[model samples]
Target chain A: MTLRANNIEHFYGSEHILHNISLEIMPKKITAIIGESGSGKTTLLAILSSLLKPTRGTIYYDDILLSNIKNIDLFRKKNIGFVFQFHYLIDYLTLKENIALGALKESDNIEELIKTLGISNLANRYGNEVSGGERQRAAIARALVNSPSFVFADEPTGNLDTKNAIGVFELFRNFKDTSFIVATHDKKIIDYADIIIEMEDGYVKNISSQRT
Target chain B: MITPLKALRKNKFKTALIFFSMVVAISAIFLISAISNGIVGMYSTMLKTDGDIIVTQRGIADTFFSDINYTIKKRIEKISNVKEVNALILGAAPVDNLPIVGIYGVSENRFDSYKLISGIYPKSNEVIMGQKIYKMLNSPKKIVISKKEFNVSGVFKSKIGFEDGGVVMRLDDGSKIFHKSTSIFLVSLKDIESKNTITDINHLNSDIEAKTTDNFIDNYNQFKIIKTSSDVISALAFLMGVLGIVSMMSMVVNDRKVEFGIMRSVGLPSKTIIIKLVAETIIIAIFAYIFALALSYIVLEIIQNTQKFQGYINGEITFSLGALIFFTSVLMAIVGTLLPAIWASRVDPMSLILRGAY
Candidate 1:
């Protein structure tokens, strides 16, 4: 079973943002989306995450069509995770509380999860009190804590410095069994990819395979 | 649920701003309501007396303007179930330079209703004054009325605001001073037979009007005008409070749109998000109401200590009115917050996510 988008098209009030976008997200693989600004990378990520519906397309998770599901939130809770450029950690919450916020299903060993993310020492601190890199790690922990099948990240290291960016990219390398669909512009992020999807304007410009 | 509280805590300045604004708005509403209730309560208590019903000139809303003939009093006395009818000369006496003083002329039987706090009832050519009037006269031993010097007989107190500032004199003297006829006739019915007595009194003459004491007290021309205007103003104040809350809620919702977006993307259902927002609003409302009630009490106490509202309240407070004020404040909060929360929840997460590009 895999996540597939077939001939997905999207419009922002007649301005074509995504034109005939089609892709397959396979299991246990890291797929990287590389593009410049306004190239519709984030838009495609949003549509594929089912946070949005494409204007013209069909999205299938495994054998089930997304539109046929009665509860989209429950589906996303069970199957998808998201990490954004700014982390968007809730300012008032401690790191543990932030990570546990959307964990609808049980996961094995939350302590281990925070420990693995290197945020155990910072767990009691509020999101804003931590450094940028720490907040990004906390965001990743939150997305992965519920043990979703796929994690989608949009410019996950955009705000971090080179060292922190490399740290974040390397963190993705350790999760080879979990599918990652990341939209980014950082070449360092692209180096760790198993599959590279390059987009220009609203169309696929190139698709390349990486040795990993 | 916890998210909203956390958000409020995080935005300390905004939360405090909302709390303070609501406190002020709710306090205004409480003051308006309390004042109106106080006025009505004082009047109602003052009007409560030995009379079961009252008779005055038809269409004369103010007893001071009433000129019911003495014949009507005699006629009412003859009616069956009539216990006793007491006639009064209600008028005002002029001071040398001060405001005109309310004067009530009564007999020994009518004088029993007012508690004489100090000294005896007024002797011939003497007058018992209310505490307010005594203070105004600087505790004078004697005062002049209509070119005659009369001794200050005593001080008396009544629950009624107007009566608390009045001069009580013999009916003959009141007539000589004000130069008017009988103003009002108080009828005490025999053993709970007030309805039939009132009907009998009404049939005696079309020129005379008869009504229960409660109705007469509530329908006083001055009280009616003041109550109507106060009620209208209080209603307006309540409306303005609701508007203030609505404006505040709009700002809160606008500022928290991204938070809502983040929650939505994290798979929080819209219903749950709305619930959390509404819960936060209710918490704020409850706190505001409590603070407003306490503030209103303090302000009312201060107002009572001032000479302006000394006799105006007369120790009469209505809890139902307080409850009404609280209920309205809470309702305003819910209406203000719920609509905006729903709107914020419906906002597209993608739009909010896209908005952060800058």
Candidate 2:
């Protein structure tokens, strides 16, 4: 699947945050969006994830316009996943319940995903009781537990230490069948990507292929 | 919904505060209703007597203002079924700074209901006192009534509280002191034709009002007015309880803004979020009612055991009254919670996420 945004613009009140941005994201490939703080990377990511509507321009998923999708929630649930900067796990629920929340069908590989994330032992612990890195891993597991075709992550490793950050990126690389769109300032994430889009002043300054 | 319940359990103090608020409001209402009913019961007991018929001024419920003329009494005595007729002079006077002490003067012929416990039958310058009045006067041998020094000829015990702290004097002496002709006429019938005597007396004169004891009880305006006014006040209190819940539930809904946002972000639709909030509120309502009833019952038991309200509330808390109050509280909880819960469901998910609320 290919997700495309053309001339996307977003405004917060009177201030223009994103200006005439366009990008193409492909399936089974890692796309990195890198920018400084307040450069609107998060807003652009949100617009692309179908969570927010752009003030101008259009977004298409496999040539199907996102605005035309009548039930956007159902589409996002089945096709796209989101990993926020904060884990956003319900504190009352155990890690396993949080991860399995994305599993709409019984066939979804929840237990295997928990094992792959090496959080099988931490499954019964609440979000507040677990370590930060483990919660981030559980969040990742949550995004992938539904077997979504694409996952959008905003600074997934921003709170993780060097060792844990490397582990998260490596885990992202292991998803051979899932596409990723990651917004980050981490050099490690940039190096691990198949394509990099550098954003400056709310514009896409450069898009380079690194998969050769 | 389960998660909301878990959150409530974790916030134990908050749960307790909400529960206590409900308990206080419900119990306050229950106590008011019980006391009102108690007073009504005491009034009914005081009015029970052997007299079959009573005659007074038309449309007058209070005997203090209700005067049956001597002519009317004589006419009622001539009625065929009438066996005996006794007139009473009712008044209130301050005796030794005790303002509004009930004073009733009856003919010596029908003084069977009240017996002298201490001295003798009250003569012209003598008075019989209830135990409460005797205590108030410090059991004085000589007591002043209506500015005239009189000897305390006797002390009597009456079941009615009003009569218990009152004075009774001879009819001629009462007439000169209170300056009343006659307040009421009590009539006894030869047989079971008490109803016919009342109709015949009323027919003799349009200014005369006559009724059997049962009829008088049913038509008494004081009891009817008090009952109606208390019920209205009880309803208002219930409304206030509902408003209390509205304010509390609104605060709860506002405090969970972040939680609702996160649920929406997880692809849980607004309907599901609303369902969870409603379910959580309903659970709280049911639990609060159970707790309130239990607490109220315990408090009522403690009160019934105490000397403060011992004579008043002899009967247990009536079941229908308690049930009505509980039903109103449940209504208050549901109506109060539903509006705010629906509003919480419409909260913007992106704003909460962007603000880093979760």
In model 1, which residue pairs have backbone atoms overlapping below 3 Å? B46-B160
Point out the worst 10-residue segment of candidate 1 chain B by lDDT: B308-317
**For each candidate, what is the lDDT?**
0.80, 0.77
lDDT measured at residue B308 in model 2 versus the true structure, 0 to 100 = 36
Write the residue-wise lDDT of candidate 2 on B12-114 in tens digits.
7656666666666676677667666656665565444546787788988686788666667778779999988888887888787675677888877656677
Candidate 1 segments whose C-alpha is farther than 4 A from its true place: A13-15, A53-56, A63-70, A105-109, A173-177, B1-5, B74-80, B89-97, B143-150, B215-228, B308-310, B313-317
Candidate 2, residues A77-165, lDDT tens digits: the string is 77777887777787778999888664676635888999999999999999999898999999898888777788989899899998998
The CA root-mean-square deviation of candidate 2, after full C-alpha superposition on the true structure, stands at: 5.8
Q: What is the CA-based DockQ of model 2? A: 0.33
